[model samples]
Target: MTQAQTLDHTSDQSIEHRIGTAVNQNAAHTREGLLERLFGWFFKGLVYAQIWEDPVADMNALQITEQDDLVCIASGGCNVMSYLMAQPASITAVDLSPAHVALNKLKVAAPRYLDQNAFYDLFGHANKDSNIRALDQHVLPHLDQITRAYWNKATWRGQRKQMFARGLYRHGLLGQFLKFAHALCWAGGVKFDKLLTAQSLDDQNAFFDQEIAPLYDSRFVRFLANRRASLFGLGIPPAQYDKLAADTGGDIIAVLRERTRKLFCDFPIHDNYFAWQAANRGYKSDGTGPVPPYLEAQNFETLRACVDRVEVLNQSVTEMLAAQPEGSKSVYVLLDAQDWMNDDQLNDLWHQITRTARPGARVLFRTGGLTDILPGRVEGAILNHWRYDAEASTRATAEDRSAIYGAVHMYRYEGA
Candidate 1:
């Protein structure tokens, strides 16, 4: 090769070093002992209960356009399907879990094919007979083998296929974990029935002072708070668990109560379904409202067709970036995935993102800290190209429901 060719190859290697490939990636957490892995999975079952991440908020922050081709992580497939509402050109949903992939596929295929009423009945009135009927008559036959097995064959407590057989919407690994917490609180004499009854600000404040406050000061809640394994259900990592726990510093229940209070006090309880699921274990019945297309009224066909335009795979953001056709994609929705990354991962992910970004392409993600993700973590070369919307990010942070994250950020990839 000539001198010019050698210089070109050297520069390519440098770029790869800065934006590492998937081959350089490791599991987000190092390989833990078998017991740790088991515990982590168990915690994942609990903490991930009911997809705690806010899809509606994500949609709003992303401001997706129909011309955009979206690549995103499929946590529960909620956001992926929801993204379709924006009429994006295409969506690629990737997940690490087979179960998540299966769930996303079912969501994409089932809703569009089933009757709109049946679609709402299934996802909206979840855990009801109408939902069960919809599943049996319209959805069951259509589900892929893995999803069908997840519904009809997976056994827990010898109750095989109960999530579907019993119309249990909140009974997935996450849902069951939540129910476990409820059982724990009930057994420990924390009256959840009374705690959930705050009709107004006055009622909420009174309940907080009279009943919930006492529980926050309780011995049981404190014990539960210390068990790092107990919080795994919420998808908190070991490091994050330390931060979350330390954020309390002393009284776990009080700190926890304050965090939960944001969902109730700042935002209307009725509007934040995440709060509803946390407080009430389910959303109020109107059925179609506030849900993705699959769960919307008279919109199942739109959702089914929309699903066809979406592809769900088990891959990381870096891997997605590597395989993307150059200049083919116009948007990337990270969705707080970066909050889970260490600096190395963040740098590599951004490197690939910059390479694939088309002019004016937008990138949006949420963070756990008040400052944006760019300052300390993102390198100078890529950071220089992207303009940070500090004002917008700040405004969004004050309104964020996931109290732990610092801010939600949006950026457009500008050329060097």
Candidate 2:
């Protein structure tokens, strides 16, 4: 290839190109492809203020040990930070979104300089003026130049400062999406705060059946729900949206209703920080309620000590894994990213995963559909190195407090 061809080829493999390729699976002129591009655009900026996946269930599946090396997709960095509590040897977090990379870096660095209470005020309550202050004084200096530049970008700085002062989880695409959904429910005479007040599962069930279920049944809401673009706020791409629709046999409304029901009724509100975000758009202000393990008071010291062990990569997980030595990392947390991949991408990812995995390595991921997505997608020759833990995956799926995903799966690398 000539120099000009090489330059053009390099441009096609840029992070922007990867995101485009991952999301735009359909024909460019098609409706599905249009929504895919829209999701890609939205995903370019801040998509998640807090990751929706349950780090607790993830840790349970990983059973991370001191000897283990982990690589995870950094959504909001909660799981990456929380994994420190497991005493992993090191963690490498990679993401295509620059916003997510910045957020993850901030979360990893803040615990080092701030006291537990101050840390809680910033990330836990996530709505104090002190958070921006903490970012400037404590976390900012520790963050890498790229992360610092991301937060300092004049266009994004104000919105991010406002997010920190108001509530970290109350901003972002996912946050704003939930805010809109909440308002839609309120307009329909449903209140999430009322559901939070329920003390028992039966009460939660009653609240959902009476108040929440009807909103899903609304013609206007159902119409909105049917469109893939409506879910862009949830950080779900068109590819995953197809699986979600398929999960309910094309009844997207039913899928929405059932997922929402699981989120509200499957667990108690006080113990579920995911529920807190769904209801209140932030963690408890009083500090007695559940929060991410990294935000817990007892884990503060652990986070501070282990924060140095984290490596934040602003790129695709497949690219990051490809740079690692053979049999390097033992734990992989894909966090539903495979749902975004095409057949070639999936095969490429598994090849790297199987290449980099150590003995008894565990790869944990979630899906938007009930079925195993890897089958017939990832090449069987490549898959020969791994075995699916069906029973553990089912239990993990049930144990996941986030309650949004259809399934959580585990693949163990038992060797070829």
Candidate 3:
């Protein structure tokens, strides 16, 4: 062959090789991005939408006092009981979930009426035998026939009187949702096993960014973007999904990435057990480090002392606020509840907050994104008087992992 022809042939082969490499890289990036999106979609659908209860953050954020009468959205009743540990005068707990109502009732009665040792064994330890014993000995006898029957009816494959028997402590809808997501992670080639074994925050963060972030960038998550019905399991109705998606610009990945990055990065992973629950279905059996406040040894006595102050109600904030006397409550905690409301509901709730405000009443809640709740929803006349400490809210959120709330806000009503 001629020398010029040989040179041209070699150059052509090099160009083809470069083109193939570029094509391969692009394909890998697209494939990875699609899977990450799927993880976000299904994760949001089955987990956050259906059965998440942010008890740890909610209780820890507000310093409840014996003199304080409080109102809260009692999603699962865990936080209400936790707050009662603070010895609040009264906790008017409300929820739209009937299932949640039944669950909360059990919690309220368990601590108030159960023997201290039994209560500790049942909830503090969350042992199956002790849970059943406590239910039979204390809780069952005190609950109304209606609620009692409800608990008696719901049974798992291996358990009877399911609410009374507590083996599946982490097998709620939320737990199952996480389990499913974890399985998906394995299937997607992102190894998350280290999360279970991470000895330090640095290890946890590295595992999350290196292993989990890639999972967020997958195809399965992108597919989830279109399936609203599948998300009902996560307790997100169609309407809320539209709003959440719209608010986050239809990219649930970015929303989750930003919010969860704070949880994984800002605090010591050990200190934030809720984050552990989020990443790993349950906490490590041996208490090598900090546990949830409700599970902490020191706080059990406090929890026992004032368990009766919390009463769970199956109603909306408007209904509960209406039922309470004006100035009856000194504190109001609404955790991401506003995300579920429309404009009218928002206005009505704030009006109740205004009327229910004692001289120095305070209100705390979370928002889906970083915006303050008052600006568009509550009237300026009422909103302007109350103080909005954005910095304090940011600080509180940074410290709390169960706080998926883009904003953890507090408003104090300094009414004359």
lDDT by residue for model 2 over 8-91, one digit each (tens)?
467435757768876888887888888888888888778888888998998887789999999999989888998999989999
Q: Indicate the TM-score of model 3.
A: 0.79
Q: After superposition, how far is residue 208 of candidate 1 from its true place, in Å?
A: 3.2
Segments of candidate 1 deviating more than 4 angstroms: 1-36, 43-49, 129-133, 143-146, 157-161, 167-169, 187-199, 245-255, 285-294, 298-301, 401-406
Winner on lDDT between 1 and 3 is 3
- The Cα error of candidate 3 at residue 165, in Å, is 5.1
Ranking by TM-score: 2, 1, 3
Most TM-score-accurate candidate: 2
Worst 10 residues of 2 by lDDT: 153-162
lDDT of each: 0.62, 0.86, 0.63
Question: Candidate 1, residues 1-416: lDDT per residue as tens digits?
Answer: 99767864775454334223222234435642332454444432312324555656666666778888888877677678777777789998876555566567666777656766666555565656565566666676887654665555545454333454353446666576577766765665655445445466665556556655566666776787766566656655444444444544544455567766666566654355665565556655555224443355555555666677898875677877888776777778776667556788788888888888777777777754334656778888777878776665665566666554545787877774
Query: TM-score of every model?
Result: 0.80, 0.95, 0.79
lDDT of 2: 0.86
